[model samples]
Target: MGSLVYREELEEDKNSAFTWEVQANNKAYNRQFKQKAFLCWWRKKYKRNAIHTAKYNVFSFLPLNLYEQFHRMSNLYFLLIIVLQGIPEISTLPWFTLFAPLVCLLTIRATRDLVDDIGRHRSDRAINNRPCQILVGKSFLWRKWKNLCVGDLVCLHKDSIVPADLVLLASTEPSSLCYVETADIDGETNLKFRQAPTITHHELTNIRKMASFQGKVVCEEPNSRMHHFVGCLEWEGKKYPLDSGNILLRGCRIRNTDTCYGMVIYAGFDTKIMKNCGKIHLKRTKLDHLMNRLVVLVSFPKSLLWLRFNPWPGIFLMLQMWPKKSY
Candidate 1:
């Protein structure tokens, strides 16, 4: 019985032969990397970088920012009109003269916003439509990046922004050494170097080898933390421990290598980039609120002046003190 137990322990050690562990005790349970585990983890945590789909449609007259402009400018214009309209001197003048400049500003702002929305739509369409290589049953096939699924093996090359978070498998560089530019995502200008597993370094030597590749990679659960990765690549009864050195995040540019191959670990919005972004809400500054209060405070003295002096002359005097909306 003791001999049998020792044999089982030795076999377990043989299968779990890994070089480094990123986390001391948080390593995945001792199980072979499986397709089901990859799919289950991806479906549970993955998200795509997507703008608000409900907003900026061609049918809508107002772009996303138009409402914000209205809140900033139109609201102030109406408040001023309400206070000044009751003045007898201003009421005698053309009412359109009071609002014409404000109307023009609003029109110009809306036009600029619409153009920006159109540009955004064009960019989104282009990215979603761009093609990448995927292994399709012993041959490589071109597939759109947007439709990429977890566990899909992708072929990457120089100067292209990676579309999804991936595990390094093989690269064209000797010893599977690759470098990438992460300036687009984390604002790092330096080219960061990455490595494929030393064990699987020679597996993809040519197009035929890459096209015929198949493997399962098990990694840490998807997380919002940038610059942290814990996982492993496994194939043919071997497990290779992986860290940030063996990972390529989405939005990073491949550089200093002709081509590389990776397995998509997380796709869509569940990626690190999308997960780390804060909520889509604006935070007004202290100065903004102070300026709004200043307008109302200044309005009080103007109204008092009209009450103190004759209403007609005081009305015109008060108009000169009016401050325009900041936005």
Candidate 2:
């Protein structure tokens, strides 16, 4: 037991020493929406809670779809054939023959992608518009999840999903302890416990006291370390150390405790869960690889035929089409 105690003390000392040289980042508080004009600007200071899972929007659909489609060598080959057909001097077939089919193919794919992305847009809207209670002045008012900002206090009820990363404060439970379920975050069904800072748990007992309390939290920058946190809450000229046990991460569900109050530390894209959300990437199937190889094989022979039969005429016509030198 003595040896274990000494080892724990040594580890704590080393951690303290390593962090002692780090500078503090104090978060700004904005309780009232009176600064309404700057609200957008303030939210921008921290990442907005709005999520965009869709790949394309109205303005980008055409160009982006075309770009993705042309990534296939077959599409490029068809396009080259269409261009060749357009040149009357070298044309062996009507351009519309290739043009119509290529248009249909691109249109079908684009329509499919557009339909899928519309569903994503609807999902994003539904989630961003979900209502939560945010502290404004001394009272809590219902607001959308996307409207939440860093340093804002939130009141959560049992079974409610946490909208952002927050530091647990006073709760209805004894000793200000809060119970939460992280099934949405880590696929765990068991309840986890989060405790409020002793100073805050005791002093901020009521809504009025909570509104009056002006505390600054200094912590590490937003990160994906879900089970790790390092910070200190400064209030009334004293700082209380905080850790993961003192936090209620986004996507967690409040359980057992009837009500709990927490201050948002990370919102929207800055939350640990959001940090872990990897970007959506395009996945090509084995069929796509085989088709590309076949297209290359077919195109090589066509190119050789064109060069052997009509290369000189095509080159001469292209040169004639080019603008004469100014000289």
Each candidate's lDDT (Cα)?
0.69, 0.82
lDDT of 2 by residue, 1-327 (tens): 999999996676455432211111223433321223364654333666778888888899899888888888899999999998998877899999989999999999989988998998999899999999988887999999998877788899999999999989899999999999999889999999999988888888899987776787777767676897888887778878989999999999999999999988777887899889867666578998899999999889988998899788778997988988796
TM-score of each: 0.62, 0.81
- Candidate 2 regions with alpha-carbon error over 4 angstroms: 1-44, 297-327
lDDT of 1: 0.69
Pairs clashing within candidate 2: none
Top model by TM-score, which number? 2
Q: What are the clashing pairs of model 1?
A: 46-270, 47-268, 47-269, 47-270, 48-268, 48-269
Worst 10 residues of 1 by lDDT: 21-30
Error of 1 at 121 (Å): 2.6
